[model samples]
Target: MALPTGPATSWLQRTGFPSQLFETGDNDYELYEAEDEFVLSVEMPGFEPDEMNVSWSDGVLNIVAEHEDEQRDRRETYHRRFRFPKDVAEDEITAKYTNGILEVRLPVMRGATVSGTEIEIQG
Candidate 1:
């Protein structure tokens, strides 16, 4: 028997998933790299700032959100984690939630060395 292909892929592709989030499950997010900072955007519907948690620990960045609708008796939860890059300044991370989207900005360290320097040999 042959497995389903085109329609199934299309269904998955039409979900408005954030870039780079397909590899994970249940939630979607996007990441952007800039000259002085990295920006992360996550899609979260029906959630508030108080319901979400974000943290940097042991070189890992984690995001978790949970909410329950008492009237409808429904619950929604989201969790996603990413490993921090070598040049990321953990202490400089900031986040904001607006219009059902969460944006996190990670600023690059000002005086940190990104590469090795070369020394001239004595003549």
Candidate 2:
């Protein structure tokens, strides 16, 4: 079968899963930048660390989580993607899950840009 073309199609294609099986979860994220690094926090409840997957590739941070509650006959899948900042050190990205909250830290390079610089245009 042929895949649809447009924005977000790339991400969906990468999953290789049927569109019907994909459901949006209540995955809220908060990003904060400090002098040293960028901290990102995502709220994902009812999930264990082992049930989640996080990875960085091609300047994109992708997060996926799947969980099933047998008692309630409920299942959940989370898929989230973020375009990482250019100055972030992808190799140094670290994450931890605690109390259903996932915290990811992306350390900024020594000379990372915290803001845009205005360049003068010469006539």
Candidate 3:
């Protein structure tokens, strides 16, 4: 079978970095922008809702999870590391987990420019 061109071809030709490789393993995410809010979707497989921690601090959204050690006697091996984006507001972030997916909604702050009109005064 053949693949599409343009962006898909570019993505295929480029060599992935360490972070990109790690991101593909266990960290799949999506960001959506709307008129009033920004949504972030994170794919967390094989993890319970209670086991993950979501927080926003200093304009950075941090998501962390610590898996329980299944074997207490033997040491475990680490495979990958995923890096999250650091451009989101931490204080305005809210998250919910259902069906093995974590969805976070962040409300846009005030100070955005909106169209308006000024009334003329008649003398």
All models, RMSD in angstroms: 8.8, 7.4, 11.8
Ranking of predictions according to lDDT: 2, 1, 3
Ranking by TM-score: 2, 1, 3
Tell me the TM-score of each prediction against the true structure: 0.66, 0.69, 0.54
- Report the alpha-carbon TM-score of model 3 versus the true structure: 0.54
Q: Write the per-residue lDDT of candidate 1 for residues 1-123, one digit (tens) a residue.
A: 643323334445455332232234444788877888888898887999999999988667899887767775445567788775546788789999999999999886776444546789999
Worst 10 residues of 2 by lDDT: 16-25
Clashing pairs in 2: none
Query: Could you give candidate 3's per-residue lDDT for residues 23-90 as a string of tens digits?
Result: 23334777777776678788777677777777765555677764444553222122222233334444
- Compute the lDDT for candidate 3: 0.57
Candidate 2 C-alpha error for residue 88, in Å: 1.9
Instruction: Give the Cα lDDT of each candidate.
Output: 0.73, 0.77, 0.57
